[model samples]
Target: MSLGKGNFQFFGGSKTLYELKQNMATIGQQLQKTEGELSQKAIDPTASMEDIQAAQKSRDDLKMRFDLIKEQHDQMEAEQKAKFAAKDNIQNIADPNEQVMKAKAELIKATIRQQPIPADVKQILGDRNNTGGEKLLPTTMSDQLLMEPLVKNPLRDISTFTNLMNLEVPKIAFQLDDDDFIADTETAKEMEVTGDVVKFGRNKFKVFAPVSETVLRGTNVNLVQSVERALESGLAAKEKKVAFTKSPKSDEEHMSFYQTGSTAIKVVEGANIYEAIVNALADLHEDYRENARIVMNYADYTKVVSFLNNGNSTYFAAPPETVWGKTVKFIDAATDPIVGDFSYSHFNYDLDVLFERDKNVRTGIEDFVLTAYVDHQIKLKSAFRIAKVIDTP
Candidate 1:
């Protein structure tokens, strides 16, 4: 009738061990009582051989029963060894009390191992790639604790994200004071609103494996210099494993990795400004070769012509015959296009500067963003499709 763990012989034999010990104590007490009763009796001169035989037989039976119990306990231990091993291999089942204590120790170790993530709380796995279209997965205890460091603190835990496009507005609206007030005049103020939606980071994008470092300092190394040499020679094992956001419920999931290597600036080349900007961006690219843009801003090329041809431009020469020279011209009162590039600066990130200095012109793009930076004195400002992408074999 026994089923599951209750039928185990070890637990059943444990009870037998207790009962046997109790029985042994009872036997000792009975022996003492019998000895007292025997001491009070007088010795019989003619003792029968049959009584002695009966006493000897009773002693042999008791010895045999005690031996049987000992054998049963020993066999109990042997029979359960295989079962315990099977449970350990198949499932991680072990002593429940010890397992719980070990789990607690693991929790403590995990907590201790995650103290190095204070600096990264501002950034989560999905910030780089905006994909809030994934399903949420259940996380283990370790996964949860590890996630705390991986997720940022500023925005609390986000479950779903939706990205909305920024809305553009047409023409500016202003308020003006009128001296004449009609008897029943109506004043109207129109509100022009541009849309910028706030989307969830986690819900929007899937995070890949996070960046981590694995140390391999062998105990055999005694000297720091030896370890240094090992590190330099690439003798020790090393790797950069990338991490990303969780996947969403639906298809067409976008996964992005958290990277901080370098940043890039956007270049908007117009008809007149195309050739000059191509050369400018080319120089930046020739210096850098490869880089990623955080964001790109595209302005109107017609604006460049407006700034140069408009009456505000200061002039050193006339409309059509100026060669490639650094001179000034005045048309309209608006500032020269050169000022716009300097002010807006197409490349404007400190991180771009840090990783892209000297050999790479990583930043300073924002200064070039607005066409006002160009003095507009150059003869030709831009050309269309002048900067073509040539494929090389």
Candidate 2:
């Protein structure tokens, strides 16, 4: 099967895909070993015919299994391409509103079966052009995908999001040393401002949602909503993971808060978690402290609660809505408590998501692939601070 940039074909779910690939590799190795054994047995002067036949059969069976897997993988790719082509036909619709719902329903039905794009739908989308069959999601659909993640992730509420189309964005920072009133006619002094450019579009991410045949084939199911919900959940989780964790590879561009070389504030000696958080807030620059909010894992919040309640099991207090006079956000991806004005952290992505479909013939499951180009930058490092607590004996 041919794989292109942003277009990957895999059989079954991600884990199953890995296992399938490993199985193929093992079978190929065994086939090669059997071939060597067969050659040796065939040439042996004292070897029996039965021994030679057994060796040959072993090699043949291994080869057959390997070939069968390859065939299935190729078939799945072909089916995906066909479905994509059918989906593209829906773009011809002139009215944007009509196109959105019509295309959604047609695509969902096409995913369940290999039927052709409806004649009316095809006519509405118009003829295919010379764009190599690549198309962006409609405006309404794009908005839905963009807003859906906010519902799934609390981090989205605190951070700034921009639909950036350019490769680089220039950030200007100005510091005015004098704002005092002077004589009305007095000349104002010019102040020097600093500016820097941050490049974007360096990070690429993909999210996949696999649907079982049973769910897709259900007559009473709202297929469109079902597929959308799965995609939304997958995208939300992947985005949060990327935003909070550092990339394993040093060479790759990572917008994670835990980027290497980032400065972290240590918890003061003899301070509790709540006090540590308060100290972290005090450490932030005064200009950013007013807008600062706190983010940490829920588990860490539970530890704070335990400390507050003196570890009493019967007298549990409800989780605090605010910590240190700032809104507290919980994300499982957060490893340490971060106190900062997250508005300075910008997350940017293309307004469109490329959608593709693939089916695992053996398992009767289909995976919806959503590919997006995204990049993020913390415009001002000093605007945020991470708290690290150290235990002492």
Backbone collision count in every prediction?
65, 5
lDDT of model number 2: 0.64
**For model 2, how does the per-residue alpha-carbon lDDT over 38-143 read when each residue is reduced to its tens digit?**
9999899899999998888888777777786666656666777888877665565566765655666675566446554454544443424235355444344455
Give the number of the best model, judged by lDDT. 2
Task: Identify the candidate with maximal TM-score.
Answer: 2
TM-score each candidate.
0.21, 0.61
lDDT score for residue 104 of model 1: 28
Tens digits of per-residue lDDT for model 1, 25-96: 554565555544343332544546665555555455444444554565567556667667666331253554
Residue ranges of candidate 2 with Cα displaced over 4 Å: 1-102, 111-132, 167-195, 217-221, 247-253, 262-270, 311-319, 391-393
Q: What is the lDDT of residue 190 in candidate 1?
A: 11
TM-score of 1: 0.21
